[model samples]
Target: MALMRMAVAAVVLLDLGIRSTDLEAHYTNLGVLPLHVLFERAWNPYEFSIHNMSGLWQVQALLFLAAAGFAVGLLLGWRTRLMTVLSWVMLVSLQNRNPMIAQGGDDLLRMLLFWGIFLPWGRVWSKDAEGQPAPASYTHFSAATVAYVVQIALVYVCTAFLKNAPEWTTEGTAIYYALSLDQVLMPGGRLLYPHFELMRWLTHLTYYTELLLPVLLFIPVGTAFFRTVFVVVLFSFHIGISLTLFVGLFFVINFASLMGLLPAPVLNWLERKLGPATQRCAGYLGGLRQRLPAWQLPLQVQATWRPRARKPGYALLPMLRETVLYVLVGYTIWWNLDGIIAPKYTMSEPLRWFGYQFRTDQHWGMFAPAVFKDDGWYIIEGNAANGRLYDLYRNGRPVSYEKPYSVMALHKNDRWRKYSENYLFVDNSWMRPYYCNYMLRLWHLNPRNPPLKRLDVVYMKEVSLPNYQVSEPKREVLCSCEY
Candidate 1:
């Protein structure tokens, strides 16, 4: 127990130390005022605009300082409940203020911190009590521990299920898309663009591993070995993402979530360290009692010599109920295999066309009638004016041409325009704007011959475009142009 406590303490100390420098930088850059601007004015969930107190800098700063103080108090176990609430408020404010800079980690950390409030974490290893006997009931610790574990597992499982796409599995092109500028990888990621084959194999392996990780949790034969491997792979994956992607602080938050995996022994040791002072105080009270007269002893003390009643074991029904609950949970997971393994992919021919058109930004325009061959669709792009058109193959063949109105009508009926408009100015709007803007810019650059019209016919083929680049047009124009 003592060794476990020491290990836990060491881990906590190390985590705190590593985070300190980054935390200071985060505080300095964000501060209090900017956060207030976000919370008091920005729209809920979609912080698109600011509404009030646009320039009241001092007030914002004060609020920020108060929030920071509260967070520190919560972490140190001082007035923890109040501090926890304040910390959550402050954390949300900070995140909302600069949503662009926030990452997945901040969200995860805030959730974990919220759970911490319900635990008796402060009763031991805190300044309020240098030595104290920690609470024996496992109520708080057990619940929080379980919640953290479940949440972490869900995160991985959900992500794995979401990535079970044709591009991810069959073509292995998901990593290529992720590393592309269209995603959020580092600027120099193009250096690895040539190694698509390697990336494809790696992507498949990653997908398989993530999908199988949850099942590995319940297996006992080599559980520790599996856990170590899982941790190492996940940590390494996160490190790569942090170094090569612009996901902000998501990795940090995930690392913190792993703290729940620590053995229970560490917590017990911390309780012992907190007991010495409590024992001394108990001794002092005992001495005071010794000095009292014999008649002054409380009736409860005299009665203590009687045998105490023992609690009965749980009834058969209650035990059976718990067993049933465990079985149900396992069954629920197994029954949802469709949601877990086979996500909504293009199951039919018509659906495949809709899927391709839907995936591409052509929801409203005419789509060329193309057959879904073995290796995806075949498509083309053409330039009519100069009779200079490039053959665009998607997977490896030529694609049939569809009318512009057909594609446009589909997009309009499906409410794609609304979807695009919402994201261009709302949350989860990350890469959508860049893609839209690039297309619009391309059209504007060739204004007189608007590339869309000039491309009289496009033959769709699946061919990789190497060093493909699009330049911004000097003139700005509305994207909605009449054909």
Candidate 2:
């Protein structure tokens, strides 16, 4: 649990760091999707974002800094419960600020924080522990524990059911389709792309693994062995995914989730193996800890010390936790089922308001049904005031129609990649002109740069054909903007 806390806090910090680079444009009203536009077209009535309270990038910076501080408190387990709630609140608010940048990994991360709020994960290896030794046994059972286990399992089970396509099942060509896209293909995927038989086998393996691995966690007998097996297999599975795809934070969050379920025996073995190294690092961190002041939250909750009879309401806390856990777990399962089941079985839009309100709404449909066929690259065509053409996507370079060396590198990060994908859809056509203008504004930020007369967001569209066939990319201008 301590390890999971540290891992989650670290990932939250990393997420904030990556997102801070795009602070103004992505989170503020001055950027592409202005607050007015978001409220008009995308915002939900129940959703709350402190980020929307101000349009200034300076305000966003302050929020980012505050979130980082809470995350650091979470990492150290200082006032663990309060820190967990604060961190989760900050994360949910940031995610609510922009929906376009979100993906399945973000959903999993938020859920981890949510479940962490209900667990006693700070009893050991935390500042709150104050040098108390590690727990004799690392296992515990509670309503929160059951809720967490179910949450992780539901991710894979729902995704697998959603992928009821022939390519994923008997046809066994899903990996081929996934790797065919030059935009997301990594070196490992490219190396394995040529082997049709291997890809077919991997496709089958992936489907079954997602479908079956979670079942191992629920077996009542030999729980330790079953959990060990699940962790080892899923760890390797995510490693393969990281090597073959550019799924930012997806594997990291999964690794953190799995860390919580590791049995005490396996943890003991690892502790013995790495004790010396851990001690050395600990000494270094200990020295740093002394140099730094202790973290204190701005507001602290005061407990009543008056000598009063134990109240019945106080005694109901455990039952309350259990009731809340079961209710939430059931709701989450229903939410996942609604996404995977037939339309008639799904919940109505009004019924799903709670999920969106709390940001528990998730879609794990990654490469589902069938792999995406429309794979392509973008070209930010800019016409300079000097009558020269520059590819602003390449930072105002000489216009070149040739394909980039790595299409994946064209995206600054996973959020940008997600936004780009959304930009391609006709449903999101309202976003294109704003994005074109954003690129134009970005390119002219430097006074010495050549001014742009106009900008065009062009996509070199190529549809991946099965059986090793390739189609020529057709130039499609998605948006054209002039100053």
Candidate 3:
């Protein structure tokens, strides 16, 4: 659990750093998603975002800073429970601010942090321990424990069941279609692209792995052996995915989620193999903890923030907490099951609102059902004041209809790529002009560059077809912003 906390916190800190790059563009009123438009179009009443309390980027920056601080606290296991809840809240709030930028990985990360709140993370390798010796054994079980393990299993099972499309089975070409997407192609994926036969076989392997491997987690005996096997297999599986796809942090987050379930055996082996080094590091960390007296004041200020273990007779808090957790777990299962069993089902208002309120609603759509066929790239066109047209994406160079050599690198990161994917839908047309104007404003920041008269957010669409057939690239102007 300590390892899981560190991994989740590291991912959160890294995510904040990457997102801060586009603070204004992605999260401010001055950029793409102004709060008024968001509340009007994409908002959910139950969805809460403290980041939206202010329109200025400065406020968002302050929030980002606070979130980073909490992630650091979680990483170091300082006030573990408090840090975990704060990290989860900050994560959900930031995600709610712009759901367009979110993906499966973001959901996984958020869910892990939410469950982390109930798990013990300050036991070892944590400042909260303050030189407390390691537990003689690393085995435990609780409501949170059961929920965490099953949560990981549900991710795979739900996704596998949702993939009812024939392409994943009879066609066995889901991987081919997925890699054919130039917009998200990775360097390693290019090498394997020619081996369609291998890709075909791998597709079936992936399906069964997701569908069956998670069952081992529930085996009644040899828990260590089965858990080890599951971790090694899926860990390698996602590693292969990372090398062959441009999924931003999805693979990494999966790796972290898997770490929490690693059986006692593997961890014990690691400790034995690195005993000397581990002891030295532990001593150093213990000394560091002793030196840090300042960390305790704020921790005391927020003393009421942490949950106290109830007295033997006090049943109300325990009962209420347990009831809510069980309801959340049951609701989560029902939500996923409804999708698989009744393909066209929506949760009734109360349940749906509950999901939104707690941010427990989730679906692991990692290319589920069918591979996306809209394989394309964006072309940001700028028309300058002196009858000059430039390709702003190429740094104000002459305009061209041709695609770049590396289309995958076009997006700043997976967030933008996911946002761009959302931008492709006609229902999201309202977002285009904001993006266009945002780009225009950015381009004019350089005084050497002439002001643009207008800007065009264009997408060159290419639809992927069966048997390696490719459609001609179509020039589609998604949004035209007049300056």
What TM-score number comes out for model 3? 0.92
Which 10-residue window in model 3 sums to the lowest lDDT? 295-304
lDDT of 3 by residue, 82-198 (tens): 999999999999999998899998888988988888887666667886634345445767678877988999999988887888989788999999999997889989998999999
Pairs that collide, model 3: none
- In model 2, the clashing pairs are none
Candidate 1 structure quality by residue, lDDT tens digits, 93-163: 54444443433454455555544544445543344433333334323334444444554565566566665
- Whole-model lDDT, model 1: 0.42
- Report lDDT (Cα) of residue 26, candidate 2: 94
For TM-score, candidate 2 versus 3, the one ahead is 2
> What TM-score would you give candidate 1 relative to the actual structure?
0.48
Better of 1 and 2 by TM-score: 2
lDDT string, candidate 2, 304-360, tens digits? 223348787886988887998899898888899985677898888888888988887
User: Global lDDT of each model?
Assistant: 0.42, 0.86, 0.85
Q: What are the root-mean-square deviations of the candidates from the true structure over C-alphas? A: 16.5, 4.8, 4.8
Best-performing candidate as measured by lDDT: 2
